[model samples]
Structure formats: structure tokens, C-alpha cells
Target: MDSRLAQHLLRRLRHQAGADAIDRATGAGLLTERRFRVAGRGVRTFVPGPLAAGRSEAEIARILERHAFAGSIARDDLPGDNDPAAVPEQSAGHDRSKSLDANGLLRAVRRSAEPLGAADVAAMLLLARSITMNTMPLGEILEALRLPAPIMTITGRVAGFEKTFLDLLEQGLVLPGKVASGEGHILSRDYDIRFSHVSDARWRVVVFAGTELDPEERERTARQVSLAAQSRYPILGVSEDEDRLPAVLRQAAGINLVSGPLDLGIIRDTMRAVLGQVPEGDIPHDHASALTLADLALAIRSGTSAKRALAVLDDLARIRMALAAENENDDGAASGKDSGRKETGSKTGKNSGRGNPGSGSERIEPAVPTGTETDRFIPRVETLSGYGKAGDWALDLKEDLALWRAGSLHWEDMSTKLLLSGPPGTGKTTFAKALCNTLRVPLIATSVATWLEPGYLGDVLIRMSATFAEAEAAKPAILFVDEIDGINTRGSAGEWTTYWDQIVNRLLELLDGSARSDGVVIIGATNNPDRIDKALLRSGRLERHIVIPKPDTEALVGILRHHLKGDLDAVIATAPERETGRTDTATADSTEADTASIATGEPAAAAPRRNEPAE
Candidate 1:
């Protein structure tokens, strides 16, 4: 029994002599009130007796009251005075031969212009799409699809663009995203005559949200947006910058114009406009309006094209009839389903017991591949010396790589493995690659975090060993480990042991250079060496520690001399051409030497903060 029916029956039973006690405690979540009893065949207040309780005025009144209050659909919305089996009559203006009843028979052979269900939603979306698609019965679009009943859920998702724009401002970029579940199927069903639904076709709705866009970046983004939109779903570019957005999006795929805080207001107005009602200063709750085709066209058509605008007014009458037919289909489907549910104990169709699509049994994302894909080797480069000759940095690195590549008979004396540590942009990774370039060897780069992506501890250790094996395959090569401090045990205490301790131990065994390939050189680069485990930093694995510092005045001058050769004359000299503009190399080199004395062999790129403003 329905909750209201149960409530009414309980209230009536409460007035009965013996049922007073049960009624006193009835105001909780208890669904039903029952008592062991045997009432007569015509009893109206008991279960399994409604079938025999015919012609009783009290029972009939109670059933009618329940339908009026507790129905899924409001009783007033149902057709034919709430009669389940009643066939509706045709409109006065409907054509005699154009009968659209369930069997193509006359709904009564008379017709008059009626209203459409989708007209409201169509108008709302048209308002969202804003200016262009007026006077086209655009609001009645869904009613045109597969005899569609317009029941679209329109949500003006301002959060998507607001968060997107602000995030881009933070990153110094406002990128666009794709629109997954809008447009096509909806448009197809709603405006089937003008546009057929293309379910598989999806285009991106890229947002361009910044105050200004770089010419090159803008060009690139525009090209990507167009190509993607043309081939797939039309891009609905949501723009926030008022001045720049209109011009930039004039030729773009699709655009929605909205101001930051006023976006919600714009959507509300558009929905009201589509629903054929005057937008109130506040949202309106009265869902009834009498906007005819002429009224909507007058509202939508922005220009003096009254002749063309009135031409489409005739179509609205047909639209109203079509909408009514589709609505009858909707009502029938709902009633049929309700009847089925009432008769059978089990659910049927659509959401029947196959289980909810969005349940918790989703699969975990696949782990990163620890095989050949990660083993890609970096090519050899010229020299790190040009990057910074703080201590003839390039020459010393080249010599080390050359000796190792030559497979020196006394290779152990060379101490193949080294650790490079310094502040960012100190040329650690660059110098490591330069070392490989000079040796004419391959550079295999991997990080500890990549190995740990497999989740479990045992898997990470195996991944770590596999990386070393791949590096050994390209023996006499530099294995550059970027961000090696990720496995540091500095903060790993009693509880964190389950993580860092295992990784640090496995890394120690892999560092034994002599036991495996003699040519395998492990060069770990990090900004913080203090965080690494002391045992792994012992005299064998990562035997040498190199510190890369910012360039000093002299080193900066040298690095500048090497790069800004011709550019310097342009910068400093205002005088006319000098064919023999030879610069003094020795003076510039000594100028660098005099300023700072760094650990001469630790080859890091120069990062001098000579002109950087103090923080």
C-alpha cells in the first residue's frame, strides 16, 4: 500500500475502539500498520479486501484522495479526466486525413493548434546558444525527434568555465576541454526534421578564457579546435574575457557568451525566454505561459525581417500538435510501466535488475610498463663545457666519458659512478647527457617514482632491478636518474619504513658496479643530497659527489662569451662596422676565475643570479 493510503487507513482505524493504542505510536518511519484480524468479506479497512469492497463510498473516496496526493505524476496532468483507458479527441484545426492516433485513426477528426512540450526546453537552449537561432522554432527542437517527448535536463554548467579560467590564470594558460554528453542525441530527438542525431560524432568544446592569447599559441589552439570540431562534435568554446572573446570566437566552431558571476543569471533568462515567458528579475515558479509561434518569433527575431519571421509562424501550429502526440506517447509509457510494476513483483526494462551501471566494481588503472618502452636511450650531444666552463666543466666531463667508453684496463681507478647535486637549472641532467655525447654512448634515463608506480613494494624492487639490467645492456653508458631524492629516507620513520626502507635497500645492491657490467655508470642528479641514505652514498655506488652552483661574474662572462659572441657587439657597440672585431678570450676566462673558486670538477650548468632581484 502507498504511504498516504496507509496513513489514511491508520487514521480511520485510530477512531476504532480497539485500534487506539496502535495509532498513538504511528508517527515514526514504520511503513505500514497491521494487526491480526478477520474482517467480513465486504470490509473496507483491511488488506486483500479491496477486491471485494466494491461500491463502498468510503473506500472509493480514500482511493481518489490517494491518487490526488501521492501519485508519481500530478493528477491534473493526466489526460481524459484521469481515465486510464480513454482515447483523446483530435484538435479542431488538425487535418481530416492526417490522423495520428495510436492506429492512425481519427482522434475525433477535428483539430486546433496545440502546445509542444519541447518548446520550453528548446527556447532555453536557444537562449543559451543566445543570439543566432531565433524565429526557427528552435525551442520546439526535441519534439521533432523520433516523436520525442521533451524531458531534457538543462544545466548551465558555469563551474566548468569558472574553474577552468581561474586554473589557467594560475598556470598562465587557459586551455579548452571536450563536451562529452550534450548536443547531438538531444538535437536529433528534439529537431529531427532539420538535424538528424549523430550519436558517435563528438566534437570538442574548447574554452578560450584568458585576457589575451599569444599570437602563436592562439593560432595553434584555433587550428586544433577547428579540426577537431569539424571532424567530430562541434566545439562549444566557452569564453570569459568579454572584449577579446567575441572577436576571437566570431569564426570559432561554437561559442557561449557569459560574464563571470552573471553567467547563472544569463542561463535563467535564456530558459525563461525559451519557455516563452518574460524573464522575471527573480526566477519564476509559475510554469504556465501562452507564447504562440508569433509571440516567440517576435521575441526571438531581432531585426526588421517581419515578412520572413511571420513565414515560420504557420509551422508552430503543426509543432503544437506533434508535441501533443509525443506527450501522449510519454504518458502511455509511464502508465504502462506503472501498471507492470503494480502487477509483477520484479522490475522490467531499462533499470531492471542488471545492476546500476555506476556501481563500485570499476577496474583499477593499468600500471606503467616497466619493459622496453621505458628503456629508451637519449642520444649523444656535443659538450656541457659551453653550458658553463666554471672549471673547464665540459672538458673534464668529456674526458671521463671517453675513458669509460674506451673501457680502460684500470676502469676501477676511474670511479665510474658519480652524484651531481645543486639548485635547479644547474645543468646536472644536461651535463650528464653531454658526458654520454662525448663518450659516443647512449643515455638511459629513469626515476625512482616510475619504478614505484606498480603500487606494491615487491613489484617496485623487481622494476628497479629490471632498469639496471636494461642500463647494463647499453654498457659504458650513463644512466641519468632524475629526481632521485623521491626514494630518500629522511622523513621515513617507524611507520614509513614499509615504503622507503625497501627501495633504499634494493637500490644499494643495484649500485655494485663491479659485480655486473663494468661500463654501467649510475649518475643520480638531485638538488638535495642530505636527504639520501648514507649507506647508498658509500664509496662504491655513487662514488663521487659533484655540486653545481649558480654562475659567478667570471663564469657568467665565460658562458656569455661562448654564447653571445656576435650578439655582444650588437648590444654594446653603437659605432659603425669593424671587420676585425676579435674579443680577448684570455682576459674573459681569467675574469670568471677571479670571481669564484667552486669545486672545479663538479660540472653543473652556470645559474648565476647576478642580475636577479632579491626576493
Candidate 2:
């Protein structure tokens, strides 16, 4: 290692283990060193010595376990005797010294709008931190920071730049991530990285937490960690979130390098990185302050038009403002402290609340009506028609719910999330309402478009999250997400890519079984199931896809009877006795056509009461 790299590693070691730890290691000769008299024999500066002459690899490896160092030392940099019993070194995948075209990099930078964005700067911070304070291999960290060619093409077009941003990242940062599976996926979860290395003499385990894992998965992860502790290779604990790991693993984590909240500079740089430039006008400081890196990633996309990016950002800013206000309101409510602002409907719209999709003008309507509304004619799953398999699914859910409520069945065993797909007016919304009645739970009705009504990306996200929160808050509830296909699939490279990407990702997080939505059954209705992001339908989410096909003739007849409250059945039974005159063929044809319209999901006219005779 060069002096600069050695000094860098030393500072990182000091940060991770403390000054005394490094001093103790040096005194023990674990860190290779050479003594030279700078001024005189008495005044000497101890510089990093040639590894070939200093400590053996085993001694260096012992310090790794003793201090619980998270950063890896390049094996080639260490000098070790050909002792077969010594600990094995992990192979650094590729050569870092390979020549990269500085001219090509400079050319890309000059063509780019700005040097970097919040993501790149954050990547730099993450890279530095991972090197200095964590157990992650430097190669792995660089792999995570690497961007795709398209992003490089956009971000590299910097207006004016002199030097390479980071010498360490010069080769790999512009390239795409090569290993995006396993550990790479974990590293890519968030911009802020906080991980620690736990080790014995033989094995190393990098423990971190954040993402939710079920009991079985947790057991599997714990077993993996234990196995890694018995082996030479280091294994990463399955997570990127905090307070979600098993207690045994959590206790063993030694040192972490956590990231702080983003600032205007990072946010601007992120925009520059993704969009090639920041939009004109000042970003709302409050919104910018409240933003997470995920939110920023969701707001910006590579190859996005500057106009769309600006719009998305503006929307995000407003959403943050509204969310901050809403949070304040919630806090006030909790503390019995009154905020002068009386609770109106939502900041985004009038029809926002738990299970309340609002009257007439709202994008979504309440599936299960309340009180007197429930007394009015509304189909229950038992009486509903035309749903076919979806109805059977609902009945099964009702049974499972009964068993669940009786504490005879586990929530994990129940199929909670479902995707209902059919053409418009196939009574998809009605199924949700009927299911709500069948399950006897409140229905929180929402849609992707409804979430966007606030006209800000941030507000839409807040609303989306709020809807899920509302559903979760009301356990034994059904969250009816209508027009779910409106949440565009993540495959599009269009103007609204970031918008849809954020929405889809947020929905995935909410719909995830780990998000504490056990009793909140999610029924996503879409006219176009193919338009949905496939991730949404993955296991543990809306995994079951049931089609609510257009009603058949028999199903239409059942639907008609439902609307008529059995009055139509009475008419059919008594028709043989009363219809002595010849039936009009045209009139009969018209009646059948209207019935087909109802089957096609056309709104049906109000029927006479069961007590009242048909007109």
C-alpha cells in the first residue's frame, strides 16, 4: 500500500477501534512499520514499512478479530510465509490498477451538465465510511457505487470540471454494478450504509439490520451467520434496516458508520447526477430537509427531461410540506396539545381518511359503507354475483378470518393480499365492499391516481403511505386499492418514470408482509393487470391473481335478482300465470340487451323495493 492509502486505512482503523487500539496493534507489530530519524536519532518518525519485512499475515489476521475491523486489507499488500495453517484471505475480484482512459472520463464530465448529484456525493460518503468504519470489502463498496452506462452518459456531461472526483472511484464508479445479487442487493437498498463486522479467529460475520424478515427467514439468517462464523468467508446479515435483526446477531455487531440526513448541496448534486442539472428556482428548504435519499432517487431518473424532473421535485417538495404539517397534527393529537389548525379533510383532498373514500367527487369510494349507509342495499359476498373465483376466494378469506379471530390459525398461513383483475365495471370495487362486509371489517379504499391528486410527488407518496398507515391502524380491515394499474409498471423509460418508480416502490414496501399489515387484507383491483409492476405480485404481496370476468348469463340473472332484492324471482315465478297474451319479441330483445349492458358493468337503474311491485 502507498503511504496515502496506508494513512487512510489507519485513520479508518482509529475511527472504528479508537486511537488506543491502533497504538496497541502498532506496539505489538501487527501494523507494519519502519523507524527513521527525521531530524536526529532522538527525533524519529515511524512510517509504514515494507509488508514483506514486517508482520506475517496470521498476525495481521489476529488483529482483525481482536479489533473487529470492518474494512478488509488487500491480501496482496500483506507479506506472509507459505504457511498452510494460516487464515485464508478473501480474493479481491479484479485488478484495481488497470489503466482507465482519463481522457474518456474527462470528456464524459465535460459533456455532462454537472459534476455529480446527491446520490454520487452520498456514494462518495458511503464509500469513504465503508472503508474507514465498516467491515465491507473496498471492492464490494465500489461495486455498489458503480452506475450504469446510460447514467454515465447523462451525468458525465458536466459543463466544466478539472480533476477526477475521487481517485479511488475513478475506475469503477462510472461502470455498472457487476455483482448485483446477494450482498449487492443489500448494499443497494439505501444510500446511507451502516454495517459492522463480527468475527472469531476463523470466520467473520458482517451484521446490519433494517429490512424485515419473518421468523423462518430470521432463523435461516441466524444459521447463515453462525456458519460464516465457522468458515473463512465473511457473511452479511440479511438487512439494511435497524432493530429488525435477531437479538443474538444484534448484540455481536461492533462498529457502524451511519449516514445523516441529506442537505441542499447533496440534493442538488443528486439532481445534477440524474438530470444533468438542477431545476431553476429555490428548493423548499423544509421539503429538502425532510427528504430521504430514496425520495430523491424516486424523484430523479436518468435520461429524464429537465421539465419533468423539475415538476416531480416541486411535487415532492409540496408533499414534504404537507406531510410535515400532518405529522405535527398527529403529534398534537397524541399529546392533547391543540394546534390552531382545525383538522380538515386531507391536505391533498377532501376524501382522505381511514376507510373513507369520500362522497361524489372523490377518486375512490368507500367499499364498506358506515351505519345507515350499510342499511341501504349493498351486496355482501354471500349475496354478490359475477365474481366467480374471486367470490370463492372471499368466502375462504371469511373462514380463515374466523379461524384467525378465534386464535386457531396464524396470520402467515392466511392468503391476505390479492390482485383482482378485470375490465372496468366488472364489479371489482363491489367485490371489495362485499368482502369487507363478509369479513366484517372496515375498507380503506384508495387508488394510485387518488394518491397523485395532491399534485406533488412528495404529497402523493405521503398520501400513499398514509393510506397504508390508515389501513394498518384499523386492523381487521380491507384496503381496497382501485385502478391499481394506474401505478405504472417500473419498466417504462418515459417522462413519468421516476414518478411511477417511486409510487410502485412505495406500494411494494407497504404491501410487503413485513410491514405489519397482517389483519389489513389488501385487495388491489386493476383493469389492466399486465400494466402492474411484477414485483407487486411477488410472494408475500398481492401474490394471488383472480380474474373477475364479465358476468355470464346465469351470473347476470343472479345479479339482477340481487338488485331487485328477490322481486325479479317473484316476477318470474308468477309470470306463467299472468302472461296469457303473446310476448313482444322486440321488447324481450331490448330487456335482454339491457341485462347484457348490466353484465358489461353498465350502471343499473334503481329497482323497486321487495315490498313494492315492479313498474
Candidate 3:
């Protein structure tokens, strides 16, 4: 049995068999569990299990049939493989023995008779996970489906996703604000089950989208999301920029249903659903558009005939793609021309130090040198020492990053932001760079000192905001903010009360600023934790505080080894000789001094030998 065939069998069984029958088969040794390891963790998947071990395809089919899983089971449906043990079980049940209603999950999304395209099915699957995880109430999904022209607006809010919406809109395949009907359209729905106690059974669901909103509007939306969550509503968020949404909104959103590219079939169905008919002539099925069903409805409502809209959209798509290709060509040529200089500069540390942070809206990569002379010699956190818990934390972060990149972990779930407190020589700043190298992400370093270089309160605040904004732009990057204690305590500001309060307040906002700091692993280094604003150290700001200790002798040795690099082997080989020499010198000198003191009828003198200094 192949993995694919095993998956196919599981899929068919879910449709044909009852939960009890499947459970019985599994319990009766007909099925065995296979474990899949991901990021040092094992995930159990139940497939044909032991039944496929020694049986032929026909025999397995018969076994399934006996279990009342299927009728008229065909041998052709079951794939043949000589090695039965080779196929791992498909991922189905976890630790739980019972099956969650797969059919019910299907019906929850497929509210209409129309077939679901890839994007639709993907959306449904994400929504189902949200419901099952108890993050979102299923009733909310139902209600969202009932709404007419739910807004799935196109905008450039998040970095990577901005291009997606922009590209589609420029091609006319996506229309902005079409489904909104002058009101917000949150995907998933709420159903008014007349006096059924349906909504009361679980939690209330609230859905909202602010992808197209301006900064001020998004703030208001964030406030609304926060209020809704405070009111005990389980929010299901639908946005293209899920990561960039306000921390409050993101925290509230149990299920984030991001809109993906729409296939031609879905587009056709949407056109028919909105306009009563699809456009005449062949519609391209090649590329998926970012357009949603609401976009189609809006386009229809905008007075353009379905046929004419389709023609115009297709034409614009061709032109957009052509322009995109041209732009790519230009970018590639420019990159090639600059690659040598950039690489050389990185190696030589010529373009190092705090990079130009005020450089327009373009992504500014902070050029903090990561405690190394050149890029090649920068040691990872694993190679460092004296960081105490911070070192262990960095290792854990490294592992989590691996899991995150592998899609087994989510960003919000990762303990990425932390405050590092230690005296000046404790390598707090160094730990940040080491963590960055260990995680293999870019480093964006800024400090309270740098923020004040511009003098004026307004300019300082702008610099502070820009640093955070830069970090967000270079997502999955390490943002190291040094001298965080410089953002003085609120009440202690005294005469500069207004200035320092504003600065601290701004720092707090940037630390948890949703879209601006999302995806950034923030490391705030401070020499004095007491001086830091209490609110800054509270949960959701820099929640975790790790005090980096001064490197002990062993740590110092390790640091030496790391810096020594090629010289480490030679140093290690001669270490015993040096230790032996020092020991012999101390013993001989102590004996001579004691003998001299005894002969002179005086008390033995304290002899400082080897590495010790004479007092």
C-alpha cells in the first residue's frame, strides 16, 4: 500500500463508513497507527494499518467491505505495492479515538449546490480547523455565508500579500470593496436560529476585516475587535494580511480565514451567481486570480455586462502580466549589477553600523554588526556562552523557527519577543545577533539613543516608529533594540514628563504595534530593568524577561574558542601543558618560601605563583 493509496482509502472510508464502524475496525487490530515526526515531535496518523501488512489489494478491499465501510469495493481502487510495511498511515485521528464529523465539516462550508474550487476547499478546511479547535464558533461561519456581497477588499497592507492583491487588481481580475455594501464583510457567518439556543450552546462568533482600511480606520477597527473580544465574542478574522492585523484583532481572531487566489471555475460560478449567467466564450483557466465572489457581484452591480467585464478583465490581466514581467527583468538586471558590491561590502563591514533608518518608505535593513569582524565569522547562539537562560532560550527559539518554517508552528504561538537585561559587558546585544545568526534571519538593530539623535520629540517618535516599521517590512527578522532603559519611567520623567511619557508610550505601541511589528522577533536589551516603563514589561509587550549573566570562566573559554576559530585546536592541545606548568610553579615556589620562612624563625609567607598577582 502506497501513502497516496492509503490516503485515498481513508478519504473513501470517511464518506462510506460510520464513526462507530471505523472505530471498531481500528480497535480490532484491522488498523494500526503510523507516526510522522515533525520538528522533533511525532504526529500519529491512522491508515489501513495492520490490515495492509500481509493482505493483497483485493483482500484489503474485502476487509473494508466486511467492516461495512464500502459497498461493491473495487480492487482497481486500491493501489498495489509489494512492500506493505513501506506505506505510512494517513493523518486522520490524533490522540482521540473518535472521528469528528468529517461530513458535517464539509457541509459547514459547502452551503450551496455549486462545487468548491481549490481555494474554496482550502478556505473550508482552514475554517473547519478553527471550529474544531474551539477558536471559532461554527454558527459564525453559517452567518457569514448568508450575507450578500461580503467585502473581501484588495489592498496593500501587509508586505508579501500586498503584491498579490495589487497584481490582481491591476489586472482587473479583482475589484476592491465590491462585496462590502458599505459595511464590513467578515468571512464566515452568523445564523439566527430562531429560539434554538444555537448561539448559546457554545461561544459567540465575531468576524471583521480591515485589510483595505487606512491607519486611522484600522485603529478604530482594532478597538472594535478588542471590544468584541472583551465582550466574550470568539472572532473569526478574514483578511489578506492576517499577520499584520492589530495584535488585539489577531489575539481575538480564533480563526483567520485568509483569501487565496481564485480559480477560473470559481470565477465562472461567481459570475453566474452574481449576474444570473457567466460570460459567453472561453474563460482562461490557466492562472488563479485574487478576486473573490464579492468582487464578481460588485462588478456586476457596477453596470458592466458580464460579457464585457470578462473581456476587459482578461485584456487587463494580459497587460498586467506583461508589465510585471518587464519590471522583474529590470529588477533582476539591477540586482545583478549591484550583487558584487553588496556582497563585498557585507564581507568587509564597509556598509555596517546603523543603516540609514529614515530612508523613505523603502525597506531599510539595519546594519548592526553581529559581534564579528566579517559576516563569515559571526558565531551562532549555540556557539556562545555566559548568556545563562538566554542561551537556552535562543536554542529553543532556533528550534521553534525550524518548526515555524516547516509550517508545524504558528508565529503567534512562538515565544519570539523578549527583554534581555544585564550590565554593559554581559553580551546582551551580542546575544541578539547570535540568535539572528542561529535563526538565519536578517537583523534590524536600533536603540533609544539612535531614536533621540534627531533631537525634536516629533522626529524622535518618527524614528522610533520607522525602526519598527522597517522590522515588519523585513519579516521573520530579528529586531534588536538596545538601551531600552533609556525610554525612562513614566512618572519619574518629572520636568520632561510630557516628552518622556510620549516616548515611552510610543515605544509601548511600537512593541505591540500589530502590523508594524508582526513577524519581527523583538529583543529589547536594557542595563536597568527598573528604569524600564512597567507597561513595557507587561504581557504582550516584552512579556518575557531574561537577564544575561556575565560570562564565567568556562563561558570565557568558549568565547575565546569561538573567536580563536582555526586556532582552537592548537590551544586545546597545549592546555594540559599550561595547566601542568602552572601547578608545578605554584608548588615549588610555595615550598621554597615556606622553607625560607621556617629557617628565619618567622611564620610561612603567602607566595603568589603562576597566574595570581603579588599583593
Candidate with maximal TM-score:
2
TM-score of 2: 0.38
lDDT string for model 2 (538-576, tens) is: 888889999988898667766775676535445544443
Clashing residue pairs found in predicted model 3: 32-49, 140-189, 141-189, 143-189, 143-190, 144-188, 144-189, 144-190, 149-179
Q: Which regions of candidate 1 are displaced past 4 Å?
A: 1-408, 513-515, 558-615
- Candidate order by TM-score, highest to lowest? 2, 3, 1
Each prediction's TM-score versus the true structure: 0.30, 0.38, 0.37
RMSD of 1: 31.1
Candidate 3 yields a Cα-based lDDT of 0.50
Give the Cα lDDT of each candidate: 0.40, 0.50, 0.50
Models, CA RMSD each? 31.1, 23.1, 20.0
Candidate 3 lDDT, 415-501, residue by residue in tens: 888999988888886777677768767777877888887665544654565565455545677878888888888878779888788
